[model samples]
Each structure stands twice: as C-alpha cells, then as structure tokens.
Target: MRAMYTCSSLYMCGTRDSIRVAMSKLCTFLRHFGVVACIIQFCILLPFLCRTLPFSTYYGVTSGRINFQQRAKMLNEDRVKHANLYFKNMMASESYRHYHSIGNGTHMYLAVAVVTVRRSGVKRVNESMGYVLQTAAGIDSFARSRNFINRTFVFICNVDSQPHKHEEARFLEPYLPFTKRYGSSSFSVKDIQLPHSDLTYDEKMHKNTREKETFDYSYCLKVAESFHPEYVLMVEDDAVPHTDLSSVLEYSLDNHLVDKSKGTPVKKKFAFLKLYYPEKWQGFAFELPRVLELISIGCVGGGVSLLFGLMVRSSKTKLTHWTMCQYFVIGVIIFMLTAELVCRQNILELRRLSKYLYQFRQAPGCCTPAMLYPRAIVEPLTTYLTSLPSPQHTDLAIYDFVIQTQTPAYQLEPNLFHHIGMHSSLGTGDKDAEHFVSTFKIK
Candidate 1:
C-alpha cells in the first residue's frame, strides 16, 4: 500500500511538471511568432480604445456629458464674441479705408457678389449681430491682407425688396457696392386674399421667398457680369471666409480652372466650382474608387507586415512549412481592412490640417454657400435660371441644370468657408447648428 501511494504522488507531480513545461514553450513561441499579430491587433483596436476610454473621468467627470456641454457653451461664446467684433468693424470707417471700389467699366480678375436678406425674430444675441456683417468683415479683411482689393471686386446684393427692412445692407452701402431690387414693391404677407385658404400665411410667404431667392441669385449674376470679371464668385451673406481664402482661390484658379495651353487663356470645362459643402456628408462614402483604394492599402500593408515577419522568423527558425504564418498574414490583412473603414474619419481629420492638400471631386448635391463661375458661363447660367417655370431652391435648381446639361462640375474638399449663420435669412433656422458648431474643416 505505501509503494502504491508513492507511485500515485509521483504520477501527479510529473503531470504538473509537464503542464508547466508546455506553457513555457507556448509563451516563448508566441513572443517570437506572434509579434506581427499583436501589432496588427493594437493598430486595429487603437481608435476604438481612444473613443471608448473614460479619459474624461480624469477631468472630474464620470462621463463625457459635461465635457460636450462645456464645449458647446464655449463655442457659442466664441461665435458671439467674433460676431460682435465683426459688427463693430463693419460700423467703423477705418476698416474699409483702403478698400478699392468697383467703378463703372472696371475689369476684375474675380467679382464676389454676396446675396443677403434681413434676418429678424432671432432669439440669440449673436444672431442679432447679423451674419452679413460678419461675412463682409471676413471678405474685406482677407482681401486687404492679400492685396486682392485691387484685382478683386466685392459687393453686397441685397435681395430684400423693402429697403427699410434691411438695415444691415444699408450700413454696408458706404463701404461696399450695394445692389437692390429696382422696384419699391414689397412681398405681400396677407394670405387671406389668396384663393387657397388652407395655406397658412407662413406657407404662402415661404413659396414666394423661394422664387425670390432664385430671382435674386440671377440678378446678382447679371450684376456680376456688368463688371466683366474673369471669374464670378457667388457667396451667401452668412458664409464667413477663411483666413486663407484668397490664397486658396488663387491656387485653385491658377492650377485647376484656367487653361493656358494656347497663347490666350480660356476657362476649364467646368460648370461651376463649389467652394463649400456640408461637413456631415464628407465622411467615408461607400464609392467604388474609395473602396478600391482601401483594399489596395490593406493588401500592401499586409504584404509588408508578412514579409517583415517572415524575414525575422527565417533568421530564428528553419521551418519548411509556413502554414500558420500564412494564416496570420491573412488575419492581419482582414484586421487592417476593417481598421481602414472604421477609422476613415481620423484619416480625413489628419488630412484637413494641410490647407493645400484638397481634392476636387464631382460636386455633391447640397447647399451652395460659395461657388465660382467662369465669366463665359455666367450669362447662359443666368438665362437658364430665369427660364425655370416653378419656384425651386437655388441649389436644387442649379443641380438640376447640371444634371440636365451633363456638364462637368466640381467641389473642393475641406471647404474654404464656414457656414456660421444659425438663423437663415430664408425664414428657416439652421437645425444642424445644434449638433455642429461650424462646418469649416480646419476649425
């Protein structure tokens, strides 16, 4: 019986020793063979970790709720501060002291026409400061900084038929060229006289306002044509220009829009070059070319990582079959591809830092805060816009024209201006402003 008990103890000890030895070998093998897999895993998981981690807890918060509210509050404060500053500047005579006027028969390289209407009934103090003032200040400041005041023409095209209703444009009249509708007639607000009693006054006004917007846009274009500018830039009164606005416009015109193959220059084959688009839509669009690009990047990264792993492993081991290594490589590729798709927004954020690194892609259908039309197309565009039978949003109308004509149109990435207006002059509040502070890429 004693010998049997001693044998049982020996067998248990041997089993424990065998398990420890096996675990040690497994650890050593993983340390060498699994290095690439570990790295791939880390790379794929990094974005998720950064997003999900409770880093805000270190700032005395359990979650990000307070942080988000604080950020929004700060942004509102900054916007109000800037708006007040711009309003003061617009009122000051010194701000436009050096500005050059677009006199009659003047030929300009670029003519900027800002379309504006009065915005009333806004509850916020910043909204009362007026978006037109801020936009004018931004453009005037940028033009003066770049010495573009001489070659460029900037003016306000006030669409408000009643001159008394739009005091902001009146304030700007002394500093900038101000255009208004010819007649003294105002849009009637009384809907009782209409045959359709079901439509509310607001609804009736909205329909009229839409048509007026289209007419106003056409009028501005015609006014722009009078200056004989080589390029016409149509800007919304609320769209604030970037600090590098002149530089980007110059670069875009010289590099992409103009054809200088012949001795005389000509416009490039494009309907219009859009300078701004909604930022929310500028994410990882599931397009064929973009998908192909991601796939190519994944393939190259996997191949490089695999080659590196094999080179290191070959130096240590003389294994003939690399079936496990090949499987690891496949997993790495899959992980990398998933990471590329998941973290695409981070990639775009990184690219936005470099102002010059912008791509021109086929224009997407959306708001048109800023657009550049070649001198040659201005008249034809004006004609087309005027001929439209029904009232349509200017953006949708232009998009329809582009589709019907099948003309090439392009939009710049990392938009050159910020859509800062919280209350739109078209009687609609910017609903998205609650979610996003500004659409400017750099900001």
Candidate 2:
C-alpha cells in the first residue's frame, strides 16, 4: 500500500511539471505574436501619419522623438495666444476709433490722400499744397456746422521730394490744428522722414503722377476699409472745396432733393455739387452758365468725386488695385473703343457694352453730341507764380465742390454716364480766371 501511495504522488508531481512547461511555451509564443501585431499596426499608421501631418511637424516628431499629437496641441495653443494678443493690441490703436466712427455714423467721410510730386517746370509745388491746405481748412470749417457733424476728414501726405522733405512737412504743419494733428506727437522730427526710395528722373516726370494717383487711391481704400462710410471725397492737392461744399454734398445725399423728385432720373451725365468758373468770363460767351450744372465733369486730376467699388483692397496682401492705374485705365479705354467690335462679333451682352458707354459719355468732350459750339472756354487769370515768362500759366479747375455719392441702391446711366470726373479748362491770361480766383479767396 505504501509503495502505491508513493507512486501516485510522483505521478501527480510529473503531471504538474508537464503542465507548467506547456503554459511557459504558450506564453513565449504570445509575446512574440504581440510584438508582430504592434509592428503591423505601426506600419498601417505610418502612411496616415505622413499624409495627415505637415512635413515640418513630422520631421520634428520622428527625428526628435517628440510626441506628435502633444506637439500639435502645443502649436495650436500658441496660435490662439498670438491671435488674442493681436486683437488686444489692435483694440487700443487710433485706427480703432477711426474705424468705429465710420462704421457707426450716419455722415459722410472725406479723405484727401495727397502725394506731392515734382513738376516738369518751375511751377510752384507749394501752390498746390497751399490749395490743399485751404481746402482742408474749408472742409474743417464746414464740418463744424451741423450738416457735416458726422463727417470725418483726412489728408495722407506723401512727400515725393526726398531732399526737400522737411519743407513739405513745414508747409503742411501750419494748416493742421494741434488737436487734429496727424500721427503721434511723441514721434521725433527724424521719425517724420518717409522711409521710401527717391524717384528717378523719368519716374518723377511721368510715372510719378500715376503713382500719386494710385497711392491716393490706395490710401482711400485702406481708410475706407476701417470705416465703411457713406461716401468718400477724393480730392487733389490743387483742389479747394467751395464754401457751400457741405450744402452741395448734403443736397446730393438727400435723395429727395436730387433723385427722388426726378423719378425718371435727371437727364444729366455726371453729377456735380458745384463747378466754379473764372468770374471774369461772360456767361453767354462760353454758351454755358457762368458755372453750368457740373453735369459734364471730367475725371481729371483725381478730384471732386465720390465713387464706390471704384477702389478696392486685398486683405491677404494689404495690397491695393486702383482704377486710375495705367494698366487699368488702358483696359477701360480699350473696352470703350472696342465695345462695338465685341457687340457685333462676340457673344458679349449689350448690357456690358452699355455700362462702358455710360462711363465714357460722362467724361467731358469724349462722346458729346456733334455741335459747332465750343464745349468749354479756357480761363486764364494768374500770370502766376512761376519762372516761366508771360501769362503762360493755365488753371483748369473742373468741378470744384463736386461730391460723388455712392450707395448700394444708386444706379448709373449707360450711354452718357462714363465720365465720372471733374473737368474745367485752365488758360493763361483769361480774364475770367482772374475774377474767379479773386472772388473766391478766403478772408
């Protein structure tokens, strides 16, 4: 019996040892399979990781052995912080008030962004600057009235002459009031120097004019973006707003005064607030009222006009596209010249052609009805302030006090609506000009 019991115990011990060995082999195989499964999973995820993640992030992750998902979270957090900081800082800028005033107000805003250019002759550059200053002063005085209380004004002066830059600054400083001064008073005189390159001789003579126009247009666009005002008053350095400028603009803006009464639309091409002519000219001599309804203002010297969608800006690049650029103007001219070509041969619509014709018709002397009469008379008054001998000086002051109003509902005429600018003739020794200038001088 003792021998049998001992045999059973040894048999049970052997069975236990066999079971332990089997379990150990199974565990080793499972461990190897688990590693293989992990490798397969990583391989499956590799292409997805490459496709979903940016190359820079991917490189930083694998090469640096950084956790990819963790890094992505950190990056997102950093961007949020930057955006918040930018918003906070922007809220504290002068642009903020300028923007809000434009957005929340009912009145119009006029921004005369000026860039002084060197002329070809000894013509006083300061004369144009003086005109602009007086115009600004006039506008400021008008704003003090109830009619223009909601209006805002600005003049972005870009000095074209590099060496004489200080002179330009001095010319402008006296006109602007201390309270309404441009830029930070804390900035030193040295900081006032424009950080731009000098213009070449050819550029100064020709391209500089276009640049001035474009720069002004661009500045208007930028200021418009911040304010989204009801109207924009684009003026030139030589323009002086008439004393009744605010009243004129108000009349134009008030639809009841201008358009509402003429439900069928006023039979005029270009709209005008006031067109001043030299007072010396006999009204009947020019076959026009001393100042005919500025109905035929030409888009010259970039003044006395208000147009919308005529100017635009790109937020992405902060770059601007001006309608007055050579390329753009050339394209517009071509479109006008070839409207009949496409009208007959191409699949273009008549409406498109009509729009172009409308703009052209509005321009002075472009598409006028054939007549034996002289359309405009040259006015010469100033023998003027120039080295040039004699009364060779001419002052073509078209549409002064012209205010172009733009609202979404406003519609333009087609055939004779193309000329959307101020046009007035300037001549040396014209008695009419002399009287006009003398009568219009501010006391």
Candidate 3:
C-alpha cells in the first residue's frame, strides 16, 4: 500500500510539470504573434502617417522637408542623374557611337542612319546623289569642327517590292559608298502600307493623316531603340545645315535667363529662350497660348512630338517597343482631349498670378529650354502666310532680319517661354535642313 501511493504521487508531479511547460510555450507563441500583428498594422498605416503628419510629429523618424531653395538643387541633381542614365544605356547597348564634347558638356552621338526612299527613276537617283553628298559634307564638318568622333549615318531605302527598276538602282548608286561605309545594308524599297478604315472622306483623310504620323513616330522610336542614343534628333533627307552647327546647339543650351518676376514654379511650362518668330501665326487665337501649353504636355499631338519620346521611356508595363509607342500616343490624345480641358482655364489664371506673386521668384518650374522647343519655328507669321493660297515668293534676305529682330522682341514679353522658340540663323541655304544639321551639334 505504501509503495503504490509513492508511485502515484511521482506520476502526478510529472504530469503537472508537463502542463506547465506546454502553457509556457503557448504564451511565447502568442507574444510572437502579437508582435507580428503590430508590425503589419504599422506598415499599413505608414503612408497615411508620413503624408498627413509633419516630420516633427514623428518621434524617432528623420525630418522630410528640405528648404524651398534646396528643391531646385534636388531637381538639378535629378536631371543630371536622368541624363547620365540615358547616356550610359546608349553606350552599353552599342546603339550609337559617342561623339561628345567635354568642353560644351554635351554628348553628341550618331547612329547608323536608315532613310526610306519613296520614289524610283532618274529624278529619284539625282535626289539620292544630292542627299548623300549633303549628308556626307554635313557629317564631315560636324566631325572636324564640332568634335564629333564616332558617328555613322544609315539610309533605309523603301523601294517597291517589284523587280529592281534601273532608275532606282541609279539613284542608290551615289549613296552606295555611304551605304558601305557608315550605313547598315538593310535595303528594301517597299510601299508604305496603310491600315484599312471604313469612314467618310473627311474622316478617312483625318484618320490617314493620324495613321501616317503614328507610323513616322513609330519609325523614329524604332530608330531610337535600335540606336540607343542618349537623345536622338530626327532630320529628314531634305533638311540641310549652315556653318557652325555645334555653336548653335551651345547657344540654344546656354539660354538660362529666366524671368523671376513672372510665373510660380508650379505654373511655368515654357522654358526661357529667344523665339525666332514672335508674331502670332494665326493672328492671336485667344486660346493660342493655352493650346501651346496643352501641346507641351506632349502625347497629344498624334505622338510625333517631344512628349512622345518621354512616354516610351517612362512606361512601367514591360511593353514591347511597337505596342508601347502606339498606346502611348493614343493615351496622350485621349487624356488631353478629355482631362486637360478641366485645367486649361486654370493654367491661364496661374499665368496671370505669376506677375504679382513674390514667392514665385524662387520657385522654378520643370522645363529646360531644350524641353520647351525641340524644333525652331523660324517665322510663324510668314509660315502662316505661305500656308495660305497663292502666296508670293519673297527674298530669303528679309528672313534673317525678321527672325533676329522678332526673336529678341519676344524675349521682352511676359510670355517667358517666348524666347524658347527659333533662334534666328545668320544665313540660309535650306533653312529646314540647316536647322536640322546645325541646330543640334554636340559641342
């Protein structure tokens, strides 16, 4: 009886110890789970806390607000980073050869150019010859004077898919050397196929124009992707250049004179530069400035403009190049026509407020001169006139004076971005061509 009672008591003691151990473990697990729950809740509330509460409200966290002046400094840093990233990617891809000027702090690289030839025959042949000679001369001058080192110009011939025409062959003969030297051998002269549309005549015309613009935009994007340029300047075959191409670019980039008295940092869209033509081309559409402001937002102009370039680069969805280009353009137009209208009047109001607002002097906007005007508009009034029916041909001499006088005059206006227009050229041969080649020299 005594032995049995001792064994039972020992067994009871062991069972109590086991229960204690299990209960202790359960408490430890609950504590761990509570910690995890708290962490999850904190993470969920993080965004709200950071945004609504001032940095001073946070006990342990660092302050978020830097001074207003420091904002510009931060932006400049960001821009430098953006430019560097673009340049490195271009180099790593071997998309284009770098021909940069250390002195000017501008990198100019040329990719193997591929031009599309539309026609065939003797006229086509002569055009090709002129194009090749002009292109070679321009590039050579760029290399010699502008510090261009590595540049290749490619020509893509879009010939008819039919049997080789003698005229086409002759046209391509002069450019053959260029083809062998600086260009890619991707030669196929095919018809530019149009997408099918069932619409009325006006609708068809509008649609066709849009489609063609989209195609050209796509082609430019393709070239950019294939070449991987830090920044690619697209020039038509007919575009020519004048003397000192690099100087023009330097001049363009050097325009940093901003009107501190006008426009707040948030309101300004146009960068400070001298416009070659100040006259209202359409004789002052009250909405001209507003329209321009909207256009500056980019993707709205059927996607061939500077904004289109930005959209393709910024897409988050691992979009294919072709699809991205197409969708981006569409999005721009759709968004502009719809949502942009809501804020149009407000932009104008902000412009008026800039003149009186003292705080605006320190707060600068998000555009550089290059970002404002990708291409120069030399004579808006004259272009407008010529665009009319049966305009008389005038001497090219008058153009220089008009451009120079008008550009500086516009600089004096409240329209701060006026100066960002065309910088008048000294002399003119083929102004468009000259603007294309000379306006964007590396140095």
Candidate 4:
C-alpha cells in the first residue's frame, strides 16, 4: 500500500512541475509582447508629431488638425491662380537657363539614361522629360552657375516595338529643345522591329509589356555605357526628380559605405541607391490611443495571470484543465492585440524606424523609377541584363539578379524622386491607368 502511494505522489509532482514551467513561459511572452506593442505605437506617432506646421491662415482656420487631403483642398484655391504664373514665368526661365548652360556636351560625369515609350498623340506635353530637365536645371541652379549642367547628360531611348514614323516622333519633339543634343544626338529609337503576337489582347499585353521595358532598358544601358560616366542614373520616362534631388543623392551615397574587403575597386564600392516609391511608408492604420489601450490591457492581464498562477500553486497539485484553458484564452487575447498593432507596418517603415539604410538582407522592393549604379558594376550589370531570363519588367529582373549575385543595395528616406506619372504605360487600360484621365473629381 505504501509503495502504490509513493508512485502516485511522484506522478503528481511531475505534472505540477510541467504546469509551472508552462505558466512561467506564458507570462514572459505576454510581458515582452506588451512592451513591443508600446514601442511600435510610439514610432507610428513620431512622424506627424515631429513635422512642423506652416504658419498659414489655412492652418490657423483648421487649428492644424486637418489631414493632407484637407490641407491640399484648402491650398488649391489659394494657389490656383499662381500655378500658371509659376509654370510660365518660373519654369520657362529655369528651362532657358538650363538649356543655355549645357548646350551640347560630349562627355559627362553623370549620365541619366531615360527610357521613353509612345504616348497618346493628343497629349502635347511629355511628362517625364519635363521633370528630368527641371532636375538637371535645379542642379545647375543650386551651384549658381549656368554651365554646371555640362557635367550631366540626359539620353532618351524610345523602345522599338513598332516602326518609327517620323511624323509620330515629332509630336514630342518640342520637349527635346531643352537640350541642344536633340535630333538623334540625345534622342534615339530602336531600329529593329518586333513581330505582332497571336495571343489574346490581355495576354499579349501581359507578355509584351515586359519585353518592351527590357528592350528599352538595354537601349539606355548601351547609350549610357558609351559615355563611360562615373555613375549611371536610370529613370523611366514616367519618373521625375524633385528639384532638390542632387544634394540628397550625394549625401545618401557618401553616407552609406558597404565594405567590399574581398574584392578590388571594380568589384563594388557602393550600393545601388533607390530614389522613389509610389506611396509614403506608413505601416498600420490603428490610432495611437487604440494601440496604447491594447498594450495596457495586455500588461495588466499578464500580471493578473502570473499572480493567479502563483496563488494557486500547492505542494502536490497541477493546474486544472479548465484553468489551463483560461490561461490559453488570455494568451490568445494578448497575441491578437499585439498583432493588430504591428501588422500594419510596411518594410519601408520598418527600415526607417530601425535606422538601417545600408543594411539589406532580402532582395529590395522591385520598383526602378530612379536608381543610381556605380560605374564599377556597369559592365557586369550589362552582362547580367543580357543573360537574364527572357524579358520581364526591368525592376523585377534586376531584383532577381541582385538576389542571385547577393549584391548589397540601399534605399533612402523621403525618396528623392517623385512618381508624377498618372498614366500606367504597360496596363491593359482597365486597371489604374484608366483613372489617369484629367478633370476627374477629387472628393
């Protein structure tokens, strides 16, 4: 009888010990989780709190509580009249100055290879070319010299999917006058032709878009490589550089230094710099108070659960199955609260909060509106492009190449380039491109 009693006691002791260890782990997890959520809430609140408000009558009227959409609405009325004045007087003057300063240059320190495609015939202005011209002009203006732009050159490559009609090409020729290196000097189109596809319209568009973009990129690479520039800045025809871009570009490059201790100067010196994205890097939509409340609840519950476990502890007892289930329920509640607070963040926001721009472990975002490549890798980059899997979007192809080669790349905060192109060039016209029509009401 004593032997049987001893065996029963040992079994009870083992079960009690296991239950205690599980409770301890659960308590630690909840405490850590609550703390992490609090940190995330603070980071989300920082950007809006840090930026200063403009001392305007509009801000005063709204008490500075207005959102970006509301502020834009108020500013539009005030600035509408000056829009034309600024474009005609300020923009025209800047363009003239930029043109005179760099009137036909043979060599360049920085070469911006622009890939252009055909636009609707009715549209008079070439959107991408205009902004690029302005950026070069801004660089010149920043230095307070007209001829400073001679160090930079813009080469426009028109992809050759269809036969080049001189009459069709002339539609955008007006934008070319900003550079004296117009008319085949700076502007070029592919001479070869691509045969029509027997695939359905949607299918053909899906397949053809990548091929066209890849071809356009290769053309730009050839033109840029010929110049032997110290750095190649690749911009799709849809992208535009902000006027204050050069300073940031230079700062970002010099600020980030990835050691290539294993290779010579030609192997790699600097990482590829990303300059633009389609959206601001905001993570989640939870209100600051909402996150704070969730965190507080989690912390309080965790403490209560821990204390309850301690109080219920006895010499020879395991937690009841019902009690264990309650503990699990509490753990789940804590997880849901923390996950909702954290899951809204994008990779961009995470990087910014982490303060790690030069450090990259995954292949970066696959958008190539504006990117700078060091001269050291230009030859190897050319080889990579040529050997890449049969034509995909240049951005994705390049990203795949980066992963394959294990190359380090960099992305800057407050993207230096802006995607002003409203029209989607490669779409089937059913997607976001159709909304690019002007005069659409903004509610």
Overall local distance difference test of candidate 3? 0.32
Count clashes in each candidate, considering only residues at least 3 apart in sequence or on different chains.
0, 20, 23, 2
Off by over 4 Å in 3: 1-114, 120-129, 151-217, 254-443
Q: Order the numbered candidates by lDDT, best leading.
A: 1, 4, 3, 2
Scored by CA lDDT, what does every candidate get?
0.65, 0.31, 0.32, 0.49
TM-scores vs. true structure, each candidate:
0.71, 0.33, 0.27, 0.50
lDDT of 4: 0.49
* CA lDDT, candidate 2, residue 265: 52
Every model: Cα RMSD to truth: 9.9, 32.2, 25.5, 14.1
For candidate 2, give the lDDT: 0.31
For candidate 4, write residues 1-443 as lDDT tens digits: 99999999999999888888876876565446445544554345433442332222222343445454434334333332333233334454455445434334555567776655554323433422233333332223333333235576554455534414323223333333211111244333333222232432112332455765665575566566566666788877655455446555554444444334556423335447777654423223476743564565566656565555556555444666676556545644654454443332222333433333423222256688888887777666655665555776678777766777778776655455545344345643222321111121111
By lDDT, is 1 or 2 better? 1
* Candidate whose lDDT is highest: 1
Top TM-score prediction, candidate number: 1
Per-residue alpha-carbon lDDT of model 1 for 152-227, expressed as tens digits? Answer: 7777878776755677778777776666654221111122211224642123343487887886787777777767
Cα lDDT, model 1, residue 306: 62
